[model samples]
Target chain A: MPLARRIIPCLDIKNGRVVKNVNFHHGTWDAGDPVELAAMYDRQGGDEVVFLDINASWEQRSATLDILTRAAEQVFIPLTIGGGVTAVEHVRSYLRAGADKVSINTGAVKDPDLINQSAEIFGSSTIVIAIDMKRRPTGGWEVYLQGGRTPTGIDGLKWAEEAWRRGAGELLVTSMDADGTRNGYDMELHQALANLVDIPVIASGGAGTLDHIAEVLTTGKADAALVASIFHSGQYTVDDAKQYLAAKGVPVRR
Target chain B: MAARIVIVDYDMGNLQSVRNAFKAVGYQAEISPDPASVLHADGIVLPGMGAFGNGMRKLAERDLIDPILEFATGGRPVLGICLGMQLLFEYGEEYGGGPGLGLLTGRATRLPDTVKLPQIGWNLVEPVAAAHPIFEGLDQPYYAYFDHSYAAADVAPADVAAVTDYGRVFPSVVARRNIIGIQFHPEKSSRVGLQMLTNFGRIVCHSRSTLR
Candidate 1:
């Protein structure tokens, strides 16, 4: 089956609030009540919702899902919870709690085997591999894990292909260099990875407007584009985003 | 005064919009974690998202399980949203092995790999039964938003109310007795979506007067 294009709204939760971090820097960034934030996205026609907890620890991770639970309680939409997920058991717990799927980054790379085990345990369709990439002049994009702090040295396209082979059902590629820049998605990175595998790729970082979303899907050939800063700051609603995509001849829930 | 309706809180999410949706139709909704509020409600909405095991754990942790089960079984009108709908089943594939409220006689399973795990977007919803009161005035194949990998098919065919296709056919709305559930967000589906909520609100007001 072809992967459906997604209009996902992301919430970076910290201390029960929706937040966003730039350049992977840890400053006290705060967005208001998570429940209210999620509800706004739902009303605006967001397809899927993601809550990435900036507080990366075992106990703090549970708080993220709790926020997801609280938001899920109000918004009848698909929820994907990430952060501090290090094992297959964590994936099961999140999915059962109400998350349609679970996303992993540092954990999957720290232990490359986690992807295989998670896919085997919960099925590949339930697992999403989130990749943070930085432009490496040596030639291909280099993979960044650990919230864009650690470098994996592996070329993104190769790793993405291996991830799908390892049982990851989808890929979420975030361009660390362009993240929060509002310039645009890394077209070079997106183009190289789009055709390398059958799994859908969620273009993350550098989305400033509806046109950027359209550009990524049309030019970059991605199935979905993950937007944070644009939607989080109220620059646009998911409905407006969908309208723009639909106008551009892209399939969206309008 | 219209029939009084209350949302089961238990510190569960979605109270604001559910309240907002009800308010949009000129009705006020109260978010109460109180068991008495649920028991006395003329129409009740139980909304959920997130994981089933933790939600059930929270229900048990907050001592809300029996109260919710009691209200649904006692014939007070109750509507379960998303995960709330999933919890009504006998069990879920999540958390390895956990028991549900058993309000509906079936288990919920994650959609297999052949279909996208989380079927996201404004896909079409088709009513299988001949337009029940809950579905009054709703356009067939109207679009509603969905976000989840697990769905209900294990329920008896008689209980199924609506079905939507997403690489595979699955139950989107199910009703039995006074219970009803919509997998898509009626509150988020724009005009058609809002109309469904308006219909639900009217159902709450007409079926009971305490909601006013």
Candidate 2:
């Protein structure tokens, strides 16, 4: 069957509220309550919801998952929880707590086997290989793990293939280089991995307008696009992106 | 009650996305890496996303291979996605030679660079058979997201459901009897994806009569 595309709204939560900025690498200003923010997207209508704990490090273990579980009970769509997820147990906790999928970025690069361990237990579909990337000073995109601190020499595209080979069901390719910038998605990164694996790829980074959504869907072959700034800032709703893409003749889950 | 879809959560596949896609539509699905729950569900989804041999090994290690084979062959409604779909075949050449469930007479193999090993992106999947129920919600020449290096070949002519064009026409969705498999992520394929899931839900609901 010909499957339609997904418009996913990402909620970067800090201190229990949605927050955003040009890039998370910079400063993040408070957006709003995560439940309220999530409900807004649910109303606007998104196929799935991704809630990332931007400050999970400073909190209790799995504080983010607890927050996600609380929010998930309220939302009808799928919720993918990320941030500070380092072990298989953490992934299990999220899945058991109600998260449909658990995303790992820093943890995956730190321990590449995290992908296998996750796929082995939770199944690859439940484990998302979240690649938080920044344009390296060396002129190529390098994967940054550990809250975007350590740079792994692995090329972004190679990492995507490797993750899939190691058994990650989906890939959340976020360009830390362009995250929250609202300029647009990192087309090069999106394009590279979009054609690399046949699995689902969620394109995150630089989503400021609906036109960028169309561009990523058409050019990057991304199954879904994750928007943070526009949705978090109330510039566009999940409906807005759906209408935008629909106007372009692309089918979206209404 | 709507069909209680059980997703087999062996490390062999992507199970949560399947459950999430169903739950998003208000359908109840449970994730049980355990086989007892898997065999008991009204309908089962084998949503896979990994190496084929290892997938079979995981199933074998958990003693799930035979039960799942019986479920698929015993007239239970089962849907397999990606590698899960590939595993339904007779065998695969991934990592090394591994025996498949042999539910369908075909083998999965890696595509050469000529067709781009992983035919990633949204491609137009053309249905080979007309009026198949699994593809009902999908639009004609609909777009489904795919990420894989291997493709199913030597499929039994009766099983090919949809043929998607990458560098060439390949089976995107295939079925035999009650078992159906899709190469695309119906969960992540957005609206069309949801439609596909809804169709599966419909099947699960319809199969409730026979399930008990």
Candidate 3:
């Protein structure tokens, strides 16, 4: 059999607190303490945790790493850190501070070679390429940077293929269209990228129920699904989603 | 005294988390590149991550290649993790080809991209040897977290303690005499992981008594 599908809980951290905003805009909503929330998720059998420093600033980075270090002490699963990671030193700092993998977005776009450089130095498995895309009026999605506010005008799918070619171990694709909608993942977006790249794709944004997760994993072909508010607000736990998916014959780590 | 577990820090594996796991299990753990620490430890954990060539280079640079072998041959317990596990073998096909520590007769090669690169996530571990003490109270088909693009390809079946299924069945855990290696990260595997480390500590304590 293949590796079991992953259920990752994402913590949008700002100033050491877990916070979230609708569609990556408007106002931030307080979630909880990142370290405490991560501990709870670890207890609930989360396959992994993605801690994105959503503020996208370098000044707050040391604070984020401090939280990551403390959180690493309490949790034993793989922890991935993203946001404001611009160079190999940033990657080293996060890994040294206890992150198993570092996800790059804006830095990678500004310098595509950053992917190759970081991958060469830290190994590909330690680097993740996160692409934030919003549905364009003209058709295909456009890649967004700076916390999904600035449009790079680069085709999301094309950029994803390039990132993979440059040695990114995995891709975390978030859909702005589906963000905060609770409708479901953009199956078309996910399927297209999943087929375009051989590396694993983690589908994020637009998740309200377990069926949505199952759909993304099975029909959507995402190797993993990243969920936020539903889990953060206690609407359902990671275990609830795993059990629901397992019942549906989707192989999930229990 | 608690088992003095020293993590062989050749600057590869996430030694901090590995140390934390052992500490959680009530064992004294330290990440040390010092040869004296490896020689005097009650047990040793050689932990590593990243490319096989780089890992080997680090070991050679630190002049740890022979001391590690000496520690293993001395019959005190030693555990290798992930790339460290791959390094225990004879050869590695990563980045063309390179020699490993040759502690075990096997080759480390990349997993097929037909499944996915860097097969990441938790997968169930099925024991090939049913009576090993490392898995004493763990359930069959127990889940463990794995993150790697390559795995041991040609190890002896006798050396395999457990196998995990990805695209093909690969040796997830291998052991010979006082040496043990696990492809999965026990430090990142939660409950099953803590128990496994505790079992390793027990093995170390038991062997120390036998030596006395």
Candidate number with greatest lDDT: 3
Clash numbers, per candidate:
19, 12, 0
The iRMS of model 1 comes to 6.3
Name the lDDT value of residue A149 in candidate 1.
Answer: 83
Model 2, runs deviating above 4 Å? A1-8, A22-50, A56-58, A67-82, A85-226, A238-254, B1-6, B9-11, B14-17, B20-42, B114-124, B145-147, B205-212
DockQ of 3: 0.76
Candidate 2 CAPRI grade: incorrect
Q: Indicate the residue-level lDDT of A161 in model 1.
A: 88
Each candidate's interface RMSD, rounded to one decimal?
Answer: 6.3, 6.6, 1.2
Tell me the tens digit of each residue's lDDT in model 3 across B49-143.
88899999998998888888898888989899999899999999999989999999899988876777688778889988868888889757888
lDDT of 2 by residue, B1-212 (tens): 55678888787544655776687777888887777887777888888776898888888888888779777776888898998999999999988778899988899988765653455445677787758888785547666667677889899889998887665567889987689999987775656777777888888877787656
Tell me, by DockQ, which candidate is best: 3
Query: Which whole-number lDDT from 0 to 100 does residue B135 have in model 1?
Result: 81
Which ten residues in a row are the worst by lDDT in model 1 chain B? B10-19
- Residue range A1-254, candidate 1, lDDT tens digits: 23335688888787778779876684546778877887788778777778776676767666666775566456656567788788888887776555656899888878889999987766565688988889888778888877888888888778888888898878889999899888999998888888787677889999987888999988999878898878877788888888888788887765
CA error at residue A54 for candidate 3, angstroms: 2.0
What's the true lDDT of residue B26 in model 2?
A: 76
RMSD of each: 6.9, 5.8, 1.5
Give the TM-score ranking, best first.
Answer: 3, 2, 1
lDDT of 2 at B144: 64
Candidate 3 chain B weakest ten by summed lDDT: B112-121
Q: Each model: TM-score of chain B? A: 0.92, 0.94, 0.97
